[model samples]
Target: MRVLLTNDDGIQATGLHAMRRALLERVPGIELAVIAPDSNRSASARSITTRQPLAVDEVRFADGERGFATDGTPVDCVRFAVLGLVGEPPELIVSGINHGSNLGDDVTYSGTVAAAFEGALLGIPAIAVSQQAEHGRTDFRPRGRGWAYEDFAAGARFVAELVAAIDGLPLGERTVLNVNVPAGEVRGVRVCRLGRRIYRDELKLESVAPNGRKHYRIYGAEPGYHEEPGTDFEAVADSMIAVTPLGFDLNHERALAELGRVDLQAAFARSIERQELAHEG
Candidate 1:
């Protein structure tokens, strides 16, 4: 199977390297090509370049594997790879092995998740993987942390197997799998829905600069509210890997129907026509 790997963390990120190694070692007969951002662009969402031209560069690893890096967002990297870089589109698109968790509403702002979303938009099956870590903790040296590379590799292998076996699965138009691995040994995998998290404190504004500028920072507990059972957040908190299916199309159908009850469309059309006539005069 051919796979396209991309991430928001840039080509040099350790998590990206670890995931590439794991895929190569475990998934036999897999052809892999990577196209990623040249620098970290986390939380960039699904932005695409429209004005400036995107730049791509050839990159070589120590092991002689060739990949490409782009001066663009995660979604842009996937778009370029599918439309320009590869001779043929890949069978699967795997994003991240991200440095942190993408749970609940975080996915809405995550470049890691957006990469997979872009692939799904292009009609390819995709997966977004994230490793949950303790906030404010820096060293992810693997150690015997149980959430080490070995454990993550195991989970990755399981996900690969599932993808291979599940035929004709409804990959909703613009659908992608968002997988979050907990910060310790995984109990097992759980199919879940997005959960809610509430932060303890609001961001605080600090002192103003001599040039009359204000600075602000977010400070608070890792303390927060969590969702009830059967949610992605709950699954991770309980030491289980969470697999949440996500989609790109977001429309409030019920809300639209309610607005339509008052002949809103006719009113909108008349208003637009009146404005156009006024402008013409």
Candidate 2:
């Protein structure tokens, strides 16, 4: 099977490299194509480059394999492959073994998740995988100085096995399987729903320069999650892998019905009548 692997952590990232090695070694007869950002594009979401043409570079990865690096967002990389830029389109797209967990509302702002969303939109089954850091280790970079592929081996191998059985997985049209592996040993895998995040962002003024430009800090604070059962956050807290099926359809059927009960047409007609009366006056 031909699979396209991409990530928001750039080509040289440990997570990306781990995924490469796992897929090649575990998935038998799997042809892999790597296309990722030249630098970290985390939280870039589904944005695409429209102002200028994207530039692509051919480079050798840590595993001595050639891959493409682009000055584009994660979604752009997916577009390039679907547009026949990476030879024939791939049958599946696997995005990430991300440096950090993409849980709850975080998926909306995640470039890793966005790449999978793009693949699913183009009729290809996709998976977005991430690994949470160990307790007190906020930095999710490679272990020590050298590239520690084994740190991400478990999650990477799981994804490789997932790809082998993807045909049997219940992947709906325009849907993505979002996976998040906990730090340390993975106890088990749980299919759960997206959880809620409790943000504690504070706005602080760092400095005001001579040019009257003020430098402030609004983000970078640690976020908390609601202790809800059967959520992705809860699954990971129990040292389990969380797999949430995300669909492209954003329609809220209950809200639609509630809004339909409102007489919006009557309100428009009343506004028109008022305008006509004022014009006549």
Candidate 3:
């Protein structure tokens, strides 16, 4: 089957390479097309470029296989690939084997997860695989800084197996598999719910330039978490692989139940009438 691969960690990242190698070794003869951002696009979410034209370039893998590199977001790579830039709409889109875990609420801002989200949006099954952050050296660039210096053999192997397993239990539309592997060997795989992560502390103003372009640093003091049952964080903390089914729909189902309490239609109508009255006056 044809598979499209991309990552927020950039086209040159080690995790991407490791994933490619592991899949080739384990799956054997599966076709893959790599299209990714030219540089690190971590935390970029599902943002697409509209202001300027995006540029695409051809890049090489370690094995000399050519891949497309674009000066755009991770989602852009998926969009371009599916639009016949790389050929056809792949049956599956595998994003990452990322250098860091996309646990808890971080998925809201994670470009790694966003790439898979885009694929799911296009009616294709997708997976966003990540290794624990501590296992790699991505302290600065999220998942792209120093992945080449770290060993992704174990994580990549886990992803290869996970991909095979997911082939059978295909997810519904608008959903993607959010997989996070432990640092070393995975004790087990647990289906989990998304957890909470709150970054504590104040923003540190690092420096102010003469031109008044102030530079600020938000140093992570310690990430805080809520202890919840069957969460991705709990699974990862227990050194097991965490597989969370994330959905693209952002509608708050529970809150929708209370929608009857507010008169949104009347509110808008009243505001519009008031504006019309003022305009006529």
Best by lDDT: 2
In candidate 2, clashing pairs total: 0
Estimate the lDDT of model 3: 0.82
- Residue-pair clashes per prediction, in order, are 0, 0, 0
- The model with the greatest TM-score is 2
Model 2 residue 56 lDDT score: 98
TM-score of predicted structure 3: 0.89
Model 2 lDDT, full chain set: 0.89
Give the per-residue lDDT digits (tens) of candidate 2, residues 102-155: 889889999999999999989999999988866333223334344367768889
Off by over 4 Å in 1: 135-151, 163-170, 218-223, 265-281
Of the two candidates 1 and 3, the one with more favorable TM-score, higher being better, is 3
Instruction: Give a tens-digit lDDT track for model 3, residues 247-270.
Output: 889889878978867889999999
Model 2 TM? 0.93
Pairs that collide, model 2: none
Against the unseen true structure, what C-alpha lDDT does each candidate score? 0.79, 0.89, 0.82
